[model samples]
Target: MRFTPVVALAAFTASTTASVASDRYIVHFADAASARAATHASQFAPTERRLSDAPRHLRSLAAGGEVFELGPDEASRVSALPGVDAVEEDLMFEPTTVVASLWKRQWYMHDPKVGVDAEKAWKYTRGAGAVVAVLDTGITPHPEFDGQLLPGYDFISDAGAARDGDGRDADPTDMGNWSDPGECHSPEGKASTWHGTHMAGLIAARAGNRPGIVGLAPEAKLIPVRVLGRCGGRSSDIADAIVWASGGDVPGVPTLARRADVINLSMGTTGACGPLLRRAIEQARSRGSVIVTSAGNDQKNANTNTPANCPGVVSVAALGRDGAMASYSNFGNVTLAAPGGHIGDRGADDILSTWDIGKRGRERSVFGYRGGTSVAAPQVAALVALMRSADPDITVDQVTQQLVDNARPLPGPCPKGCGAGLMDAGATVDAVVEDRGRY
Candidate 1:
């Protein structure tokens, strides 16, 4: 009863200026001096010309490249000009063809070109026996996770941060994390977020259930490990949760019957990976868990963000519908990219997943859109689940290698480096299954 939808390929028609019949083109210059010389040359009419109806300047690249709207004949002339390295058409790219789903909002899951292509991977496995531990603000009960939830634990040490009036406990229910003005560091107040539930839904929300959205690995089990809370979470709590979630003992907390096949950490802070967190991640990886974490939302180098910067983890960066790195997503040192969606008009381009209605506390559940590297990490986590489901004996290194080897290049450029490329769930899972045949 998998919710397989008809895929719709978006057709794009290139348009030309009606007045001048011009198309966009980029002229790459050999050097900055050449670029400046071309601007003053009479043959090259730069967009800044005083003409009232002049060709538009689309963009100016920092590396002495100029994008302009030029007629085909004019483009040829520019290409033949001295000091011009090359002239190429400015091409337009969109997210891989979208799948028409029941909700129609899960574009990220269905985009086969730039997305993880979970739909294609589903033909092989739905991550049946894999377990994913979501370490975040915790989760709220929802219909999307009816039989997919595992007995999770609360690891928030501070009662105030937990907002549950207790220290550490077994209940991982998300007690609203609404904060007062200046409570956590910000001047304005913040809402509960329901961040964990959204991430869980991305990983394993049921597929054929009702009219709701489908997850990447619908059959994968989710263990909601509460670490973040009211303001945020502590490094110590997160470290302990990582160890316990991977079946390591955490003193009073009972050990998990099954270690998580994939550990999803969507939370992070600015600084080097602390010794405690790094050790915990190493321990989890040693136990055969594939750790996936967000590259952060600061749009800076990911090397400064904890857990993501730590070794032996897949630090993921976010991609928008245009197949480029999200404007707010961290770039350098990322393991790969995934559809994290973008802040579009009225939140049209954000990732669609399960969410709660309450602004300050738990209320009725609903489907909503959120955009960030936080949302991107879970998709890769689910992909790991699917890979494990395909070949249960695959080692953590093998899994990582398969992901890197099978990933396709981003449709656009990632100047700061986005690891291997974008994750291709179908190719990765297929490769794993094929490799299993060899053995």
Candidate 2:
């Protein structure tokens, strides 16, 4: 009837120094008293003494049945204990691309010929204090974000497209965009791309973790506004999201607690901008938020694209790793080109970013490659964040001017209308510092 005394974790660590595996096990008990009275301390070694670096006294072996390191035999014995409920292994997750395979793949972020020079720009600013609203499919929980992700609004409006079977509330998690052939009028069924997740990673995935891809602006915050869904989001829903993301008021929707300094529209439709879209952009502009849109992947004149061609929008085109226009990227009216990958690259020259490797019932966080104007736009959005971090008072007009002024000509033959030229993150942030110094 003797009970094991609850001793300091350091003492427990020093007392039972048995060889053990790296697997940490969680043992659940029916009650704290049963755990405290149990004499299983010798069988199950205390793993993490402190509960996330809490005080020593609070990390006793009997302190709320904390985690323990146990081998197979030891774990089995512990599971058979009188009051033990269950035993499971503790798992760690690093949310980013596989760095070994990704270092060479992410040439779009560093290659001077076509990349955005994120390395140099990062030296200037990592986009701290700035917020970029991703108006795309929702976002999911991942380790790539170090508490910099904000709870964003889901403006799907249509329950069917939402796939979550709800119109919209505050949950912006991307429920896989999987769809049947007839769903959303697509010619064939397609798996979800986790588009928003990839975009968010590009804008600000946690940096210096030593495992995965680093973002252009690692310290920036992301506000994921889920406007697009299953097949494609309705323009009405997208317009509402734009308005709400910029801290503008929308009927029936709650007010945004924080406004975005920059809004990214990676999705777009063909034809001129409609009244609904125009009104939302106008309102967002009035609130001092800059809107950045993809120049469409249709390989046609971007002037035919809706939001890209919208007044006051900074439209972006795509460039391949070779410093040439991506074959699929639409031209004309483009603000500038960023690495979006070319069709000829197959998977070799695609933009590498964070993604989920699973489909349907088996979802796991992993990194993959994708190419399109959609991928290109986030590069600029991240650059804008760095600019905001450097000069909080910088206006949308100033962003446009700085980009135009600092752009370099295309390395090879330029397309019909590549706007100013290529997006130079180093030059852009330097220009901001220079402008501030002058003023």
Candidate 3:
């Protein structure tokens, strides 16, 4: 009906919201239209779950909280929870992370501490034991990923769950936009940007070769999951995608997808997040996926964004090239910082990276410039991939500590924002290997 950014989500920041119905209560719609709306709006697709008619009494309602994938049994229990009826799948993947100002080049991959070091990557770990799922636009067939792109399901389709039935899609091409950025375009059809592709490049763009650019983890593989389509995916779609990415099966999707060790979501709604997204994130973590999300770029504070504010997830704030907190970055509870660029008197002061040319609106190939906390998220994801590769048993806690403890702290506004400091890739890698010595 009407297009809104659906930002500054209330569900995400709020401690809790009133439940709509019992997790297991039979949803009773007052009329068919109401049920149809719930069905259509649901991410479950063709075969959705809903109440036939409105219940005589209200048992509970949904609130904002990233839900993780639940085993069929867990689903039942969640249904058994006070305010949960049919659990409409929600995508826990938040794809918008980074300072949009950094759409060009921000982080110094060459810095010794954070520098791009293939030699060291070879010496320590090549990221073989890990699987990273990039829930954003899409990925083109590229040499960098080295056929590491696993099979993924798309949630953008009305049929519910897009499958590459042809078994195609293993490319590493960049999808870009010029004026617009991100697959999460404004529904008004304003612009486009291949933000997701660019972020992946920074994380795992083929390394060791003297090609266009270098990545943080050359040996890591990315699971391309397109949750945010044209104008971005709805909360319901995101929730479903999250369950699927973390190795869960919805009612219709018979096959349980392979779970990801690390899930990177760069997107976010500006307002307090709705229950739609929060439950999915919570469920994914329950399934054992470390969600590394971007703190919103609303130019306000970090404590505001959905998915980012969800607990257990490692929320990252932004920093500038000057090595200070990026003016546009939201700070509070910030697990770590990366180059998300800064807001300037003129506009955005970005420390960017090479993005998919498509987002830049390129006619030729897929490499362009883009920025935002969306970009910063991948750098951290790549580092985690490396950590897992070094040690397959690496826990989420260890990976987080490596990023924070090894980060190069910058001048901060205080504990209110920016929990740790700036992220250093080289330092993160060294810390894991030196400390564990196991993997």
Candidate 4:
């Protein structure tokens, strides 16, 4: 079944009533001393709530910092303070999914014009010794991942959202995200997306061994972390997933033996990146994890999409078969573009990846075609895996820089905001192997 575009997370709580502005504000100070000074200051003291979850390493942005109820005037005043590094209005967010038609072939990964050059790039490296974390709806036991899958955990904190009748367990199986009509407060029900399965297949489905489509990184290992579920997942849950996937601790969750070299976030919210998410992303980066996220499919500027809009992520845009930007893909913050596949080209033009068969509860192994920025982000993530394989010590910044510098120019409407242009897998691998950064 084709997946619907994901609704925005609850983080975007704005009203059309111009008279009533958001009063909640988040302030980031330059240091602990500054945060303490600001918290005690007459202006900040009266309104600060002192309720935050950020860790000590995060400094002023952590729990040590303070959240406040403030009007626009006061927010502006705080933004101008020398001690305040940044001040933003507290808001909610939602995840965006790209729309696509269903197809059953894997031609999108083979075609040169619109596809990533995975074949040639594979010659340089099959992404050995690299681990990719798929932070979405967990994975099913598909043969395409015989020896490529790694031990993973389910990070869905809410038992109802997990749908497995439990809260946060180690089992990362996809129990099906199918929902009854209005089950998730929706006007209509949704089919189990099996989104993580599709993404894992694209990144590292076994090559030349099985009857299924070959993944971009045949030798790379995949770590599935279930975040999205039932109706959708919470942004807070996703934040913790990011930290855990990058080999960081999450209080009670068990520590992972292997840390991810590349973290693929095919999902995100629509509002500004909250401090919780920003903290997770920064921590992941500090551990040398290259983060890749979808640019969204709202047909608007991607700079407005969280996680993608957040700094330190390689935000991806979707390209169609005609080598143009997909009509639904978000732009602006795109770090690079990839074949998200286009609709109306029949099934031949859409991205073909692993999927499941049967209705919800009775799912089986299968492959299908779909397109969206979600499809595009995994392509970038896989390439990063290859880059990491080529140079095991590569940093997050280096991998992103290599992709941007070696990208081929776009041939369509996107000139600037669509990133450096389409991703060239072969060239990107070559650059990494040659150690181009030193030059």
List lDDT for all candidates, in order.
0.83, 0.79, 0.58, 0.78
* Model 4 C-alpha lDDT per residue in residues 161-189, reported as the tens digit of each score: 88799989898888888998878888787
Instruction: For residues 105-220, write the lDDT of model 3, one tens digit per residue.
Output: 33345444333333455568767767788887665554445665677655654322222332113332333322233323443334445666666677766533333555666567
Score every model by TM-score: 0.76, 0.76, 0.63, 0.74
lDDT for 38 (candidate 2): 41
Deviation of model 1 at 68, angstroms = 73
Instruction: Show model 3 residue runs off by greater than 4 Å.
Output: 1-107, 112-122, 159-189, 207-210, 254-257, 342-363, 411-416, 437-439
By TM-score rank, best first, the candidates go 1, 2, 4, 3
User: Over the full model, what C-alpha lDDT does candidate 4 score relative to the true structure?
Assistant: 0.78
Model 4 stretches astray by more than 4 angstroms: 1-105, 343-346, 436-439
Stronger candidate by lDDT (2 vs 3) = 2
Candidate with the greatest lDDT versus the true structure: 1
For model 1, where is the 10-residue window of minimal lDDT? 4-13
Clashing pairs in 2: none
lDDT of 2: 0.79
Model 2, span 10-87: residue lDDT tens: 243454344544346676666776555443543354456422221112223444455665555555655665556776
